[model samples]
Target chain A: MSVTTIAPPANPVERFLRTDRMPHIWCPGCGIGTTVNCFTRALIDAKIDLDHLAIVSGIGCSGRVAGYVRLDSFHTTHGRAIPFATGLKLANPKLQVVVYSGDGDLAAIGGNHLIHAARRNVDLKVICVNNLIYAMTGGQTAPTTPGQVVTSTNPYGTFDTSFNLPHLVEAAGAVYVARWTTYHVRQLSRAIAEIFQKPGFSFIEIISPCPTLYQRRNKMGDGLDTMKYYKEKSKVKNGAPTSEVGLDKQGEIIVGKFVDRARPDYRELMVNQMHESLGSRFIDPVAAECEEGEPQGCEEGLCS
Target chain B: MNADPRGVLSGTHFLDGDHACCEGALAAGARFSAGYPITPSTEIVERFSSRIPTVGGTFIQMEDELAASIAIQGAVWGGAKAFTVTSGPGFSLMMEHIGYAVMTETPCVFIDVQRGGPSTGLPTLPAQSDMMQARWGSHGDYSLIALSPNSPQECFDLTITAFNLSERYRTPVMLMMDEVVGHMTEKVVIPEADKIEVEPRRHTKKSPAEFLPYEPAEDGVPEMVHAGEGFRFHVTGLTHDERGYPSMTPQTQDKLVRRLRSKIDGANRQIGLYEAEGLDDAEVVVVSYGITSRVAQRAIELARVRGIRVGKLRLITVWPFPEQLIRTLAKRVTAFVVPELNLGQVVLEIERSAGSHAHTISVPHAGGNVHRPEQILDAILEAAK
Candidate 1:
């Protein structure tokens, strides 16, 4: 009797990814892929219409995520992803816009945009994968590099104070804020799904590994060793004040869903303020333009 | 295509060039704009912010020029005719994003209300100094369309043309307006929507399976699909293949860059727009654009009374340089008298095109002010000699 082998079911997340574009440019043992895996899972769990999802990225290793995902993606210039996504979200309020980029791309070069987008509370979801170094440019010192970490630009260890991303964005008025690691895939994916359902500027900072340049140069071991460290050191502190959650070299890692509150987003304020001032004369242009309203999401709190 | 009637203001109004440009954008169906407040150009956005609410669109004051520049591109990909306004300093900050727009073939407009620059030299003064920058400001080998308007009426008219060109070509179009035209108040008649022409975006007719994001039609321009259109297209600043995936090979680079340039260059005959007067029997031809063109017209009049057979060629489409016209004009004319607010920017192109056939005289101005008609009249007289 001839034995027959049946192929197991294809991974559900594969449908969400552009597997043909793989193997991605990411290096061996890079945690970016792991974070991407979680993001795809989050997209599945959220049950968002795949057609209505758009991903924008800036220049960096993490910026390459736009190419790997099977969504309407844009790989824009460095430091402008948030504003780009802001325009995208405002132009077509029905689309779920997400900005995926790295610490250097977001916190260093794009810091102003990050704060302003949060301040306006534009309806966008930003995923910042902080690897503590600019891994794409051969490990330059990033704004989020821990004190005393040796990077390519800082041979004697970095003396610059790092950004507590959650604290910064929370203070800037992001309605939802969270922190997790590549190790906490389940929890991180859940947090990402939550941001999709929420309706304002939401941010999640994922602590990922850069074994090629960051870990090897700093003697922090490889990708597996970094995961071991995360498992041992991470403290699951839900509702922890953002100010106390700063990362450091060989220190406690705080990871959890930190801030969850409601505030009117940029679009809401624009519509509400304009409607009150202009009265019946004002029609929501996006709504007025669409004939069938097939991609409809503009009608929220317009009359009231 | 007919414009959306809701956006049309449909009445005569005494308006500044900046405000008229805003009305033109609305009439042309630009529902999104992002800008930062910079002098001269700020009035464009100031008018837009208040007017857009009534028109049913969105206007944002971004954190800076960099944000403003890229934000409009985001809106363009999201299925809206979009633009951003800025002056010299802001325009300089927007160069990288301009390159990004070109690389991705994102259709949009950038309005640079020209001012004295090389760094914030004069905030409220006129200068045509940005003409060369408008052509080659962004780093790369690429081509773009730029329109220069001399008055508030043309400002209102050319801005609509800019939007149509951007959509038709799927490239960024620059409206290179000087501070004089931007701030000058004049009579501008707002035509009804039925009278106005707008180009609807070239969305693909092919199904998602047959569409390749970067594949060009016969015109060398690709059709666009908005973000939520189920096409799932990818656009990147990196050199890309027909599928919109990054293909870093030099072969892909050569093919992509060549197409970017050839699309605009090959359409030179159709893209070139100018007003030529007395060129049939003229010894000297005066070339000018923007506010300088209005000044040159006076100079041409003065030269005619002085017995110099002087003609006028007022440029409306400044980029693509109108080289073919200049080459043809050179064969008949003795010399070309080029007067501009800047110190000899466009004159260099005149010299190149008129090589060995005719003399090219540049009437340069440092530009806090317009050229006195006498200054250009003397150049015309000298060119005739």
Candidate 2:
């Protein structure tokens, strides 16, 4: 069988995408590209109005995802994407705010934001790319780098325990929590699409490969070999215990959907609170004008 | 300050520094305040949270400083003048968002009631160590407008000023108050609403469809559009073009950085708000800001009575350091005395700006106790002789 080469579609979705700066600074065969593809596909699949989608990302290769998206995106400070996304979402609940970040960017430095957003169940989606190592700064040891892994910072091997992200998300009360690998493109894309469809705080952790950093140092070969490892290792069973999945020095990877549920979202709660506080005045023009000048009134002691 | 002839309003009352800042934000029309309570600054948040809702604004106790800062940013984008208050550790957490506000050109106010720290040192005590951090803490080469208040009245006045400058410049303005000013109680007259000049944001007259959020106008400040207004501009941490999309080209990066730097720097003349006392034909100048400046003013009087040539230069806007004024003073004065609560922070800026023309000395303290007027007077007398 031969694969047919067809001319690219005019007004290709990729054209609306940010592409002039590529080839991206990401390493060759980096999972970031696959994750980006999945995200764009998910966005397209959901048929979300692109004008109303706000993609926010923090510092890291994964953080660069926002820059490549066609929507109103914010590439914020290191480990600060969740909070930035939270602000974007709260400012205009009409917009879909999605956070694209790396494990270190989200779980490590931005750990507080992730847990709080989940606890509050803010109306946002966080697609965390867990490449295990901090790939952007030449593979420094990261919060997700498994025990005994060696990197530039952890030259003597990592003694620090790694974060179990899906469990953390689940524990933090994320309405949706799932894990998938770049190898499972269709599954990953589908997971992103589904998570985007849900309202509350949905979290999708993508277990991606860091070929240049994690692979080369850990002897996982190149990108193809890494994907193959993921292909062989990942268990498709739902709700499998994390302990059930293990890896040898050169072993199989594990990936699958973990959790899906529902809870009261932050936006709905905020609107309810606003209505209760304002009563019938909530819809009054005078109250609306008062809302506009309320800050000044508070300072003047009139409101206090 | 004299009370207005009109009877005190129902909600008006004599309050402390922290409460006054809250009042100032309210007066200047801050509709949202999101903050994680920290010492000295906590009262501001507590009072704001309780009072904001009554006024039809929102006060959110965010999970942390990071969230708090971002929440306020969201409120500002929602078309509300918003603010957050924190101290030391919380300020450190807010540094990243401060950079965000600068990059996105969002108008907001950050009140850092500074405390002693490398970590969480002296939460209750006063310290001005965050002054330098306020100027350049966020890992970028951008200019900011930071104001320090010397009294409770100034605290109230400057908090309102901070928001005004924020809206005027389309950048985050830092209210760098310390523990003393943040907690000290004093009488502050609540001015009539109409008497206060509240500057609404410089909204683009051009339709939202034609708006480029990051494009600088002739005044060097970019026009801002609220999120629901249908502007299609992007906001990013990366060096971006006028359209707000990431632009990696050297020329584009240069323009972005230059515009960010120049917006505040170019407006330095107008934004270099300060107060000078007794500087004409004086040989000794005592430079100070925030609460310590009050003590410095008293010290100047003592030195004057003692037959010493003494003057005072109080910095109102600290970030765009009043270098032009400092240079002129340095040429005329034999020495500059800088008295601050922190152990020699702003003194460094004073010394640098003074260059080789004047001898600069620091009267540093960590603020468990206030600097003595006699001590500063003695320094002035020595400098004069």
Candidate 3:
């Protein structure tokens, strides 16, 4: 008869997660959980204001990041996370807003927003998990699904060429652009943390496994196999030109921080333009939040 | 709740409904807007984009209506009074986010300066075609507020009301306009900032540890908190529990759906805003809204001169349908005449509410323009007989 009170597992990442809703919807050997684990580590290491951090996600398996992250987060409508995060950052420039979504969510239906968000240089950290297929709605052909890859919709294999996201973001004016995989956990975390200090749009594309559908159909085995493949084939070439860093059809994952430069984010540009146009009368909406006597904007329903 | 004097124009100016709507949003403390420029509704955001910088907010021209709609929701969470304006095509695109706002109980406004559609049927012309769409375009079982303004002045007035109702209800409020009103120019007085009463975002006073994001107050509206203020609450479009965590169970779905329905349905009486005239011993009642209400007013006058005892009920708040008023009036009036720019949308609700008590007649007009006073007068005269 042994009556012993055992303590819970002292996992550091548990604090950042809504473990009450654990045993997530992701399939066995899913890489999304690994991405989340890396992100949590990045958040912890960044040592930024957790309260000021707000995560926005679109509809997908990766979109569940907002639900799990113990932060001011929003799981918005599909493919609108970038613009939503743009609004969040612009509305309150003090907020460290992040858009975490999937390839189907970000690069397909959300592609326009992704490019425009980059163009505007909205201060947002965007983490796009590319499983190379629409895993949530079944193995539908995603914009990132490599050519000749068979999907639910494309049994004949997709003819469309996949987007090189790091190149796309860099070309669209992102101040920071990086690519990593679930296998590159430490580098991904460091890269994610580095982007925390950078201004303007920062993008990190995580190439992950879709074992249940993508791997099963493609005959690429499971997530562990994908991780092993990444470990063996992934090339880390930091500061490589974005144009030349695109993934090859031969399964060589070109992983690196391809671009990092200084640029005024959307808020700074707005504030500057407003100061020039409206002069002293331009009571910055973000600044207005800190004023004591100047009719507090967030009262009642006036959001800020 | 006075508006920030800086944002308020605070003077009389000849303005169109679209422009007036913009000023109204500004006066009501809207500091952020995300929009896609579409016909009729473009002027609202066009004016807002230029004016917002002066007033200290953000105006983002999103790539599409879907992004625009959801962007405002994010801005709302980030502590900004936010909105988006669009025409019919854009409205259709925004339907998804409208449902999302309802599901998440986020406060925002969507101004639809309606153009003819079934698929871009008329981009530049007026239509009341989206009346039913405004009420039910968004999927799922949730209730929302919709207001119609007849004149540029009412446009200014009701846009503020729409924002206030959105704040009070914690739902996306629709400002349903037509091309005529949206494009028509008229004198609109911008009231003093202190004179305009605006509802402050009802922020939760409870500490973050004690707060449940979806937990409702007596009014069935949960108090809100903005992002970056240390309230690490979650909001989603999914069926969520009081903690704002998604719950897919039947019990959770039933509780959430019922509350969504009852919150607006039960408060229809209080939410209803309409003007009723000539009800006593009236043989006919003319029911209309938006620009049609103006034409209906003329028709009601012409019918009165013709000795037709026609009463007028000009609806200002359209959704939640003012069902009780229509039912009660049906018991008294001999007949009810509904004239709308669209062919029989709100008329369906009118007929349903009238039931067997009164004869319901719809004077339908298919898009492109407002009804001729004669057409409505003829309906009123026929109903009176």
Candidate 4:
């Protein structure tokens, strides 16, 4: 029997994107572009209104994504995109807030915000591009950089151990946690599509290659070479542990969905709690006598 | 009693500096506060968190100082005057974002109730060591408006003034208090809130669609529109254009940086808020701020009774440095006595502002104890003789 392969529908959403800016700032072989492509595709696939979406990012090469996007964007201070995005989400819950940051941004300096947002299960999507080095700062050590990896700050070999991204997100109680590399473009795109559709704090850590920084220093050569390496090494698994996935100089890369569950979103919980506490305040009473009173500044309007 | 402008009730109440700062912020029309509790400043957050919810506002205890500072900025962008309070270590963490706020022209307030520092030096003790740091702690060459309140009442009053200055200039205003002022309790008369003059943030008269986030107006103050207002604006830490996009050209960078620096510096006359006591005929003047200013005031009074011609110049706004006032005061006073909890932080500014004409003395201390009035009085008598 003959089988037919279908192409992705001519993405009508490309009209909303700045295609001219592409082949974005990521190194040619870097996985960040694939992840970004997937994200843009997911936004298109979900049919989210570009005008109503706000992309917030912190300092790093990956953080620069906000600038290239054709939407309301905020390229904020280093390690602060998550909280800034959190404020944006809380201030206007109707706005779709997405945080795009690097491993050093979300895992190191911004670790506290990452974990707390997950714990609160804020209704936002966080796309953490894990390049395993401080790419923008000339390949310095990052929280996710593997032990003994050589970089600008740790030329003699880093003594620091790497963070297990999926485990950390799960431990932080994120409602959705997924892991994918740039090599698996279709799968990463699908994961993003599904994550964006689900509510609560959805976290996806994209294991991207930083050819100019991490790759060159580690003798990983150029971008295409790194992409080839990712394609050869990554295994798209669902529940595999980081410990089970060994990091070999030329070995397998573990990538896939790790956790997905239904959980109460932050805004919904906040509104529900408000109604419970302020009972009649939220709902009009049917058997109450009406009386004239001084005009009160609407409190509900303030939240928006 | 004078009619209050902010509607604060008239009543004498004993309150700590942290509580006073919170009250002051509320009276100033600050509808948002984001902060993480640290030594000496935790009470401010605790008080604000409970009070803000009742006043149709919001208070968030952010994960850390960086988050707190960014959250405050977000709140400001969400159309509410905002503030965050921290101390020593937290202040260090907030410096970068503070610089971002300055560059982006976001109007907000930061209350740094300084303890001994370098790194968490005597977290619960009073120290004026952050004075110079407050002026230049942020990474870039930018002007800042920082106020030092000497007492709980002033803490309440200056916090309101800090918000006003921040709004007027479209810059982050710092309220530099100390452990002494933060923790000390005193009788503060809560004037009818209406008696307090509140400065509403200047928003563009233009429709949100036409608002330019960083264009300077005639008075150097720009109008702001919050995010989600359908005004597509950008804010960045890098040197940015008038439209707020990052710019690499030297001329563009120069224009952006100069306007940011000059807006506050050129408005020094309006932003330089200070109190001068007995300056007309005094031979010796004590220049002090924060908790140290209280000691200076007492010292000046003591010196006057002792037949020493001593006066006081209390710096309400520490940055913009009150240079012109100090330079004018320098020409008349024989000597300047600077009493601070830190080892000569503000004294250096006083000396630089005083130039070679006046003899300047620094009465420096570094820990839990404060500079006693006698110590400053002795300096006054010595300078008088």
Best by lDDT: 1
TM-score of every prediction relative to native: 0.98, 0.87, 0.96, 0.88
Candidate 4 lDDT over residue span B1-385, tens digit each: 2222332535788998989988888788776778898998899989886665445456777888989899888767756678899999999989988898888888899999989877968888888888787889888789989998988999898988898889888999999999989999999887776577777768788875576667889877778876655565667777767766666799988888888888888999888878887889989888888888777778888888888877778888889888888888899889998888888888888899899879998888875779878898888888888
Tens digits of per-residue lDDT for model 2 on B242-347?
A: 7777777999978888888898988899888889878897889999988888888899988888878788788999988888888888998899998888789889
How much lDDT does candidate 2 score? 0.80
Give all candidates' CA lDDT scores. Answer: 0.91, 0.80, 0.88, 0.79
Clashing residue pairs in candidate 3 (N, C-alpha, C atoms within 3 angstroms): A299-B200, A299-B201, A300-B200, A300-B201, A300-B202, A301-B200, A301-B201, A303-B79, A303-B80, A304-B79
* Candidate that beats the other on TM-score, 1 or 3, i.e. the better one: 1
Cα displacement (Å) at residue B164, model 2:
1.6
Give the winner by DockQ.
1
TM-score of chain A of each: 0.95, 0.86, 0.93, 0.84
lDDT per residue (tens digit) for residues A54-85 in model 4: 88899999888877766677889888998888
Poorest stretch of ten by lDDT in candidate 3 chain B: B49-58
* Model 1 TM-score, all chains together: 0.98
Better of 3 and 4 by lDDT: 3
Q: For residues A90-117, what per-residue lDDT tens digits would candidate 2 score against the true structure? A: 5455567788899999988899889999
Off by over 4 Å in 1: A1-5, A291-295, A298-304
Q: lDDT per residue, candidate 1, B14-76, as tens digits?
A: 999999999999999999999999998998989889888887789999999999999999999
Q: Lowest summed lDDT over 10 consecutive residues: which window, candidate 4 chain B? A: B1-10
- The CAPRI quality class of candidate 1 comes to high
Candidate 1 residues A204-254, lDDT tens each? 999999999999999999999999999999999999999999999889999
